[model samples]
Target chain A: MTNLTSLTIRQALDGLKKKDFTATELTEAHIKASEAARHLNCYITETFDHARKQAKESDARYASGRAGLLDGVPIAMKDLYCTEGIQTTAASKILEGFKPPYESTVSGNMFRDGAVMLGKANLDEFAMGSSNTTSAYGNVINPWRSEAEPDKQLVPGGSSGGSAAAVAARIAMGATGTDTGGSIRQPAAFCGITGIKPTYGRCSRFGIIAFASSLDQAGPFARTVEDCALLLQSMAGYDPKDSTSVDRPVPEYFKAVGQSVKGLKVGVPKEYRVEGANPEILALWDKGVAMMKDAGAEIVDVSLPHTKYALQTYYVIAPAECSSNLARYDGVRFGLRENTDNGNLNDMYEATRNAGFGKEVKRRILIGTYVLSAGYYDAYYNKARRVRKLIWQDFINAYQKCDVLLTPTAPTPAFAIGENTADPVTMYLNDIFTIPASMAGMPGMSLPVGLSADGLPLGLQLLGKPFEEETVFKAAGALEKAANFTALPQSLMDKAA
Target chain B: MSIDINTVRKVAKLARIRTTDADAEVLSGELNNILSMIEQLNEVKTDGVEPMTSVIEMNLPARADEVTDGDMPDKILSCAPEKAAGFFVVPKVVE
Candidate 1:
C-alpha cells in the first residue's frame, strides 16, 4: 500500500520472497501508476493483461519456492524488442501491427528469469533520433522538469527515451534498452536513471530490431547501478541464433556491483572537454573525478584524438547499416503496405515506406543509400570505415594508460522537446560524448552524478575495455556510493498519481 | 560533397522508394546539409589503415549446412500483407 512501485527491483524481489507483498499487488501498483502517468507517453502499448498474468504466474512460483532471478519484478521493454504475441512497433508506423511470431533472444532470456512485462516502452521511430520526438507514437515527456519552469515539458533523451522515463517515473523497476549510438546512455542521463550498453555481442541481438548491426547492443536501464548489474546478469549470454554473440561465459556481473575500485586507474579523457560544452556539465565531470579519487581510485588524464570524428563516423556507418537492415520491410512480407489502388509492386514499396517512416528515418535511409551508391562508396562509406578504425585505435591507445575512462554523458542536461529537432546537425551533436565507445564496441554506462543549474539531473559516463563490463560496474559502483545520488522525480510521480 | 536534386532522385530510385519532384528537392537540401557534416571525415588521414568491417576482428563462425530450422510456413507467413498458397502474394510480374 505504501507505493510498492517506488521500490527498486532488488527490494521488490526481497519483498516478494518475504511474503510482505504479493507480485500481483506490486504489478497492480505499477499498472495504476502507469495509467495515471499517461501524459508522459512512455509506453506505446500498456500490457495490463499480460503483466497481470505474468505476475500471477510469478506468485505461483513464489508459493512453490521456485522463484527465478527476476520473479514477479515488473519492468518495461523498449518497443524495438519483438515480443511473440505482443505488438512490437519500434516506435515506427512501419512496424505498427507487427506481431513477431518469436521472441527476441534477450527478452526470452528475461522471461525465463521470471521478469514481468509492464509494457513496451516508446522510442525513436526505428530508434533513429536523439530525441523521442521522432516516435510515431508521440514524444515521451521527461519526468524531470526544471524547477523554475515546472510547466515547460522536457524531453527524455532518446531512442531509449521511454525506458528511461518509465524507470525515472517509478512506473517500472527497470527497463530494457538498446544502444546503436548513445540511445541508452543519453536517455538514461536525461531521465536520471542508470543505463549500460554492454560490449557489442555481450547480449544477443537476435530479436531486437537492428539499427546499426555493428553498434547496436542491448542493455538495461535501472534506478541504480546494482539494479542494472542484476538486470544485465540475466540479459547477457551466448546464443547461436545471433552469430555475433560471443561464446565467452557470462560473468556474475551483480557480484562485481559493490567491488572496490581502490587501486584502479581511472582515465579522464581530454578530448571529451569539447568546445561549447556546458560549464556545469564540466564541473560535474570534475566532481565525478573527485568522487572516484576520494574512493581510492587514481584519476589520470588521457587523450583520444579521434574522439571529435566519432559523430561523423557514426552518422555514416549507422545510416549505411540501417539502410540495409530496414530493407526487409517491403510490403509483401510484413508490416504496413500502402494500398495504392491497382499500383505496381515498386509503387507499393515506395508508398508504404514513405508513409510508414518519419522524417529522421527517411533522412537516414537516403543518406545511407547515397553513401553506399556507386562512385560515392569510397569517398564516404569507406572513408568513414577507416575513421571508425582510427576511433577504435584511439580508445585502444588510451586504455593502455588507465583501466577505465570517464566523461560527461552529454553536452548538457535534457533540453526541451523540439529545441533541436529542426536542425539534424545540432541533434547529432547530442551523441558526441557517447559515440566513440560504441564505435570501439566497449561497455559504457551513464549514472546520475549531480544536478544542473536548472536543478535537472546530470550524468557521468564510464567507458571500459571490450567485454569488460565488470570493471565498469565496479568503478561506477564506487562513484555511485561517493556521489550518493538520491534525487528522484517523486513530485512528478505524485502529480501524475 | 553537396548533393543536388538530380542525385536525390537517382538515389531514391535506386532505393526503390517513390518521391516527387518537390520531395526530392527538399531531400536534396537536407542531404547536402547532412553531407556537409559527414564531409568532416575527410579531415582524418588514414593512408594505411584497414577499413574496419566490424568491431571484433573475427571471422564469422561457420555452421554445418544442416536443416536446423523449418516446418512453420504458416507461422512465418502469418504477418504477410498478402499471401497465396504457401507463398507471399505480390503484384503480378507478367501480364
Candidate 2:
C-alpha cells in the first residue's frame, strides 16, 4: 500500500485492469490519504461520494471490458475549474458559494475519459500570487517539510500551490493546474513534484475562471513525469466552444516519454543567470546539464536577451487582460454580490467589488485599469506588447539552435511564506525563469533535480517550441529517470503513515 | 511617473474597489515606486515597433454565427446573489 501511493497513473490503471486492485480499493486508499494529509490544507473541498460513485462506475466498465486508459485514476481539480454543481471559488472571497451551470471543458473531458475527481484543490486567490498565502481561505502549507522544522515553513509556491501540495502529499495521484506566468511550474518546483503547462490553447479554457486569458493555460501536476504526460494526454484537445482553442489534433503524449534524448539540442540561456539567482540554483543547472550530457543530449549556449523584460511585460499584459476578464464578476453577474441602494448603479458596482475582492486582487485590478486607461494605454500596455514580441522572437531564435531550452525553475527554492509577500515587486521576481516561455506561448515543464543546501527541493525547467510538448516531456522524463529525486519530506511521509 | 493620492484613489474607484484615505496615500507611494521600476522600459529603443497582443502570432479562429451554449438560466442564476424571473437582478439605473 505504501508503494502503491507512489505508483504512477498508468501503473495504477494497469493494476486495476489486471484486477490486482479494485477501483473502489484504490479510491479508498487515495481518499484516506487525502483525509490524513488534511493538515497540509491542500484541499478546499472533498468529493468522497462523487469519487466513490465514479470509481464504482469505472469498476463496472472494467467488468464490461470498456475501461479507458485512465479508467480508475483519481485526480484533483484546481478550485478554479467549474465542476457543474460543485462550488468553484477560485480561492477568492468574491466567488464564495458560487457554482457553475456548466462544467469546464477540461474537467468534463477528464470525467469523460474515466478519471475520478477527488476534489477541488486550493489555490492563490484568482491565481494571482506566487505563494499560496494569497488564498482567502488561508495559506496552504508545504507538505514537503515537518512541523518541527519551523523555519522551513516555506510556501508550496503560488496559485497552483494546493494542486502541487496535494500531489506531493499523495492526496491524489495527479491534479489539474493552470499556469499564467509560473503558477504551475513554480509551485511544482516548490513542492518537489512534476508539473507541465502545455502550449497555449492545447486545453480549452471555456469554463476555467479567467485570470489572464492570453497567458492562462491548464495542465497537469503529478509525482512523476510519466504521470504528468498521461494526464496531459486526456486533457489536451480542441473545443469549438473556446474560439482561441487550437484545432490541432491531440497526440499520444506518453509515447514520447522514456524516448532517447540522443542528439537532442538543449539550449542554456545566458540571460537566466541573473544577479540575484542563488548560487546553489546555478549549480543545479550545471548538474542538470551533466545529467543530460550523460544521457547523450548536447548542451548549447543560447541567448534569450529579452528575457530580462519578461516579468515587466507579463505584469502589464496579464493585469491588463485580467482587468478586462474579471469585469464579468461584477456583483450583478453570477458570483458574490453585496446589496446596495436600489437607485445608484455605480454604488452597487463599487460596494459589491469592494466588499467581495481581496486586497491583492484589488491592487491588481487597479494596476490593470491604470495601464489600460486611455492616455497610459500607449505608454504601458502597448509598449509592453511591443516588448512581448521581442521576447517571443528571442525564443524563436534560441529554438533554431536547440530543440529545448533549460534553466532553473526559480531563482531559489521555496522561501518563507511571508518573506516576500509584503513587497509585491520582490514576489514578482520569482517568476523570472518561467515567465519567458509563457510569454511566447511555448510549452514548459519543471522536474525536481536535487535539494538546496537548506535541504529544500530544487527544480530544472525545460521549454519547447509551440505544440512540441513531446520534446519537453522526453527531456523531462530523461532527467527525472536519471536524477531519481525521491526526497519526500519526512513530514508528508509521517502524515501518510 | 509619480502617481499622487488623488490619482490612486481615482484608479481604485475605476477598478470598483473601495479605498480609505490612508490606503490611497500608501498606494500613491507604492504605485509611484512600481511606475518608476517600469520606467526602465523607456531606456530601450523600440522605434517603429508594432505592439504585440498575444504571444502566439497565429490568427484566432472565428466562431460561426451559431448559438451553441445551453440555456440553463436557473442553473446560472443559482449562484447569483439576486435573481428574478431567470435574469440577474441589479439596481435600476436609467430614467
Candidate 3:
C-alpha cells in the first residue's frame, strides 16, 4: 500500500484514476490523519459527512469517466472564505456566528472542479497578525517538532497558519490560502511548505472576505511546487462578480513547472540585507543563490530601495481599506448583535460593535479612521499612498534586469506565541520581507530552503512580474528539486505511524 | 503626537467600540507608544509626490449602468437584529 502521509496530490490523483484506491478510501485516510493531528488545532470546523458525500460523488464521476484535475482531492479552505451554509468566522469573535448564504468565488471554483472540502481551517482574525496567536479560536500549534518537547511549541505563522500547518502535517492534500502582506508565504516558510500568492486580480475576490482589497490575493499551499501549480490552475480565472477581477485569460500554471531554469536571471535585492535579520536566514538565502548559480542560473544584484517604505505604506493602506470593509458588521447587518437600550440608533450601533469586534480589529479600525479623517488625511493616508507609488515603481525597475527576485521569506523563523503580541510594532515588522511584492501587486512564492540552527524551517521567496506566475513556479520548482529538504518533523511521522 | 485618555475615548466612540474610563487610560498610553513608533515615517521627505491608489494604472472595465441585482430584502432582513416589513429597523432619528 502507498504511504498516504507521503503522497502528493498528483500521486493521489493518479492512484485514484488507476483504481489503486477509491476516493472514499483516500478521504477516510485523510480524515484519519486529520484526527490524529487534532492536537495541532489545524482545523476550525470539519465537515466529515460533507467530505464523504463529495468523495462518493467524485467516485461516481470517475465511474462515468468525467473527472477533473482536482477530483476527489481533499483540501481545506481558510476561514476567511465564504462557504454557503457553513460558518465562516475569519477566526474572530465579531463574526462568531456569521454564516454566508452564498459561497465565495474561489471555494465555488474548487468545489465545481471536484475537490473534496475537508473543512474550514483557522487563521488570524481578519488575517491581521503575523503569528496565529491572535486568533480568537486559540493558537494553532506547529506539528513539525518532536512530541518529547510538547511544551516547546513553535508558531505555525499567520494569518494562514492553519492552512499551512494542516497541509504540512499531511492532514489534507492541499489547502487554499490568501496572502495580504505575506499571510501565505510567511506561514508556508514557517511550516516548510510551498505557497504561492498570485499576481493581484488573477483570482477573483468575489467571495473571499476582504482585508486590504488592493493587496489580497488567493493562492494554494501544498507540499510541492507542482502541486501548488495544479491548485492555482483550478483556482484562478476572471469572474464578473468581483469588480477588481482581471479580465485576462488564465495561463497554464502546470505547463512550465518542469521547465529548466538554466540561464534565468535571479535578482537579490541589496535592501533586504538589513540589520536584525537572523544570520541563519541570511546564510540559507546565500546558499539558495549559490545552488541556483550551480544549476546554471545567473545571480544579479538588483536594487529595490523603496523596500524600506513598504511596511509604512502597507500599514496605512491596509487599515484604511479594512476600516471600510469591516464596517458591514454593525451588529444589525450580519453578526453578533449586542442587547440595546430601547431603539437608540447610535447607542445600538455602539453596543453591537463594541460587543462584536475584538481588540485588534478595533485598533485597526481606529487607526484607519484616524488616518482618513480630514485633519490627518494629508499627513498620514495620502503620504503613505504617495510612497506606495514609488514602491511599485521600484519593482518595475528591478524586474528589468531579472526574471525573478530572491529573498529570505521572513526576518527570522517563528517566534514564541506571546513574544511579539504585546508590541504591535515589532509584530508588524515581521512582514518586512513579504510586503514589498504585495504592495506592488506582483506574484510571489516561498519555497523551503533548509532548517535553522534551532531546527525550525527557513524559507526562500521568489518574486515574479505581474501575471507571470509561471516564471515563479519554474524557478521555485527548480530550487525545490535541487534542495530536496524532505525532513518532516518527527511529531507528524510518529502520529501517522 | 502623544495620545491621551480624552483622545482614546474620542477614538473609541468614533470606532463604535465601548471603552471604560480605566480602559481609556490604559489605551491612551498604548496608542501613544504605537504612534511614537509610527512617527518614524515623518523622517522621510516626500514633497511633491503624487498619491498612489493602486500599483497598476490600467483602466478597469466599466459595467453598464444597468440593474444587475434584484432586491434581497428577505435575505438582508435575516441578518438584522431588529426588522420591520421589507426593511431593517433602527431607532427613529428625524422624529
Predicted candidate 1 versus true structure: per-residue lDDT over A239-317, tens digit per residue: 9998899989988888888898998999999999888878999999999999999899998989999998999999999
Instruction: Give the lowest summed-lDDT range of ten residues in model 3 chain B.
Output: B30-39
Each prediction's DockQ against the real complex = 0.82, 0.69, 0.61
**Which residue pairs show backbone clashes in model 2?**
A130-A158
- Candidate 1 achieves a global lDDT of 0.91
Off by over 4 Å in 3: A146-150, B91-95
Native contacts present in candidate 2, fraction: 0.65
Pick by DockQ: which candidate is best? 1
Clashing pairs in 1: none
- Lowest lDDT sum, 10 consecutive residues, model 1 chain A, at A488-497
Candidate 1 is graded, for docking, as high
TM-score-superior candidate, 1 or 3: 1
Q: How many residue pairs clash in each candidate?
A: 0, 1, 1
Task: Report lDDT (CA) for all predictions.
Answer: 0.91, 0.87, 0.86
Candidate 2 lands at a TM-score of 0.97
Model 1 regions more than 4 Å off: A493-497
lDDT of 2 by residue, A157-259 (tens): 9889989998888779999999999999999999999999999989999999999999999999998998898899899899988877888888888889999
Most accurate candidate by lDDT:
1
